[model samples]
Target chain A: MTQNAAPPPKLILRFTIIGLVIAILATAFAYVGGWLDPGRLTPDRMINTLEDNAGVHEGYRRNHAKGYCVVGSFESNGNVDSLSRATVFETGRVSPLIGRLAIPGGDPHANDGMPPIRSFALQFQLPNDEQWRTAMNAMPVFPVSTPQAFWELLKASQPDSQSGKPDPAKMAAFFAGHPETKPFLAWAKTAQRSSSFVNVEYNSLDAFRFIDAGGTTHFVRWGLVPEAPFTPMTEAQKQDPDFLSRDLRERLDKGPQRWHLIVTVANPGDPTDDATLAWPADRRQIDAGIVTIDRAQDQADGPCRDINYDPLVLPDGIAGSDDPLLSARSAAYSESYNRRTREEAESATSSTQEPRS
Target chain B: MNPRTAGTFSLPARLLHWLMAIMILTMLFVGVGMVATVSERHVWLVQLHKPLGIAILALVIVRLLVRWRYGTPALPADLPPWQRAAAHLSHWALYALMLAMPLIGWTMLSAGGYPVTLFAGVTLPDLVSPSPTLYSALRFAHTWLALSLFALILLHLAAALYHALIRRDGVLASMTRSRKQP
Candidate 1:
């Protein structure tokens, strides 16, 4: 009878030891690598280091700097004399600014002139200030009024239910589910179809609070009216694809592209907490100062690409209202930025690996 | 004689296996790196992580199909039943995790109402709506699951080493592509 041969006890011992050693080594490595640590450092700090270090390497003072300064001055109805009548603070210098112009769509590379809203994020650094302030496409009101509505809107904007493209049905469902978005929808639809000329109008869809040196607070909606009137880009003009870029470039090449910053205050007695509601024209527009964009400059490749622009980066005087959208946006942007930079470093490492002989 | 470990894995299968191993390991490390970062620095990491997650997701699907079509070499007969079962179960879990992590991350990002950029400014749509509660829960889940995955990986490495150095059954040789015979 053929008997099964049993492995030697020594063999078993050896295997077990080997296994244990490997396990021990792996655990040690993991612990030293900080994998076992309860994520104390947090993702946001990592991103900030990446930006600051990268920014220095890129020859820029701040990672967000886009190489040009924008000074936005407010004017009251084209009347220089009326400027004094308004609460216009002459911001002598704003620096360390970052700007991103995006086509509003599910796809990042969606056509600039598509029938969708465009987003322009501007983050400016105030002198003698420690923080930054950001402005976006929508004015006082965000697309979603409440947290739940915001969630629904986000879900609706996801890739198509079937095709993985932006789903119109889903978008419609979102708007329908949150009727409060009706106001934003009206503006979104109009902005989507509107010509590039709309870019000239600085509309504040959100309401912000402006605190004075004396601790007095005023609810204000900020707007920008170009020295020139709105000139809608015709279909022919839009064909350039880089219509906005080209226009800005040309304007900058000639000289600084300047716009008047207008801040319309809420009625002194009646303060509006919600930015979604439009401020009455009778409230009177104040001349804040001019925002001028000088020649476009390029920073080091890294900073231009990796820096994040969170709207919550406000300075001392400009504090955020209890805008839930602003808070959500701040958190979301921080999370996303962290995730992306880590991936970049990994990919860069892998791509640069030397082949094992 | 047991019919397993008769020959090396096919070149294509071996290539895919190694490639996937490197990618997954990198992904795990990248994730750990991300969690370690502070929020101010996390922005850039988030931008790159999603695209890589999507890429890994795509690669995993392809790897699964390849494995199904071209079956992997069976375990050596010397491998105890428990070890064999453990290996199989661990591998399946890895596969499951490989898919789930990316999907969960994408969903989390979508729920946060942020566009997923693959790379080079290529933005994808949000997969879900932004909900603080949902995001908080998912973020917690993602972190915990990742820790569990790292543990499983350690076990896997241990098993492989056992077969290679202790059992001397050629398991590691099969994966390592050494010229040494069992």
Candidate 2:
């Protein structure tokens, strides 16, 4: 009979109220700390800041200034019905896909064989004015999660004026503070550079969601895996300035160069918000379709030259993930598109005026 | 000899209770590590965290099923109504959170387009579509649930201590000590 009994109802009610109050307060704190509101940071301002700090090259893109355009057809096997509801995924739908493959750098004249990350961007125009655009990179993961952090990374990595070399102290400090960049750096230092763009597997670092007609939804990230085996360049091959683009052109002349589009689906408890984090390889993957490049074109006069490959241009059944970098890229690409297009327009008028004068 | 079964939890219930305790504590620490560390190990820790969460979810399911099948021992007659209600509420809350946190985590990852890799290279199917909006909501919910679970655990621990040390009651022994019923 000395055992303790349950407390009265009033006391229980009081405890419950106290617990709820604490929960609400904690939620408020998280919101104030910027965990709940991911959109509080703007991509436009970050892009402009990068341009100002990095010194914008007048007619060139803020990044990936060097590229070669190509024309291709993305034919669907119509077997994607179970995975996607978009018409582009339907069988026998042969839509024109314009693409650009480039070595990573701000200078358009950067040597082709110089070791650098490669990029592959594509624009798929479907039947109903729906466009699916994506830009892929050789790097599996990005360096940072947010635009603000990306700006900081750029600032930190900037070479000192007097030395014309990046300050090791600044880089060390940056790396020490930002451990998320470690995996990428480790891979970059160890990975051998591919001799040709076609030999590289290009990844769309951001994740996207696809909804099927049955109201089923899947979170997916895609990559264009090259059929060409990877071959590192020799010293002789490194001497060629346009080796990648030139090799691609020659191969297209012989026959269509192809790549497989593979989409990986996410499981429970996976990290989806950070592009810097990679998903484990054993995850479920679906081979959606094949992308065939039947022709090559020069960037100066190519259809893809002026086209902005905003990754957010998704068709029905496809949508953007919560990765902050995805939206940031979309904004930055549009900004670059507007600025470059404006500069081209002005240059056109100026050349006409100069000839008249 | 029958002290455990007469007024204490059965052997299976006691084992599951301790197992869950260790797992929940480990989960709290791992959750903190996942956020606090930025090293290469952070990625490894995240990989570990996913499987651990799924394990907790699975264990909690079994624990609940066992509890439902085999009724718990009665509380002491002297225990106040408020205290009894509090104990019942807290226990159920812990169970709810254990089930929810992992499921929410899975849904969040699915929405964000990341794969949840369990131990032994197994991956579960996505339960929802990838939408930035939905992903954000799930992420927020997961964090909150973790925090709530943390708070509830602390309260539970404090109550357990009060029972064991201050009351000198057999309540704590019910789950801790296992012996055949008289």
Q: Which candidate leads in TM-score? A: 2
- For residues A1-357, could you state the per-residue lDDT of candidate 2 as single tens digits? 453344434555555655665567456545543466655443445556556544666566667777888888887777666778877788777888999988765556768876468999998876544668889999889878876677677677676778855688988898788899987888888888787778888998888888898868888888988888988876777888878887888888888888888888899777778888899999987777789988888776676766778776677777777787765676566556656655655555567531100
- Cα RMSD (Å) per model? 18.0, 15.6
TM-score of 1: 0.48
Chain B superposition TM-score per model: 0.86, 0.92
Off by over 4 Å in 2: A1-45, A49-54, A352-357, B1-182
Give Cα distance to truth, residue B10, candidate 2, Å.
79
| Top lDDT model | 2
As a TM-score, model 2 comes out at 0.57
Q: What share of the true interface contacts does candidate 2 keep?
A: 0.03
Interface RMSD of each: 12.8, 13.8
Model 1, position A11, has a per-residue lDDT of 75
Taking the tens digit of each residue's C-alpha lDDT, what string does model 2 give over B76-136? 6666799989999998889889999999989976665444446322556677864444554
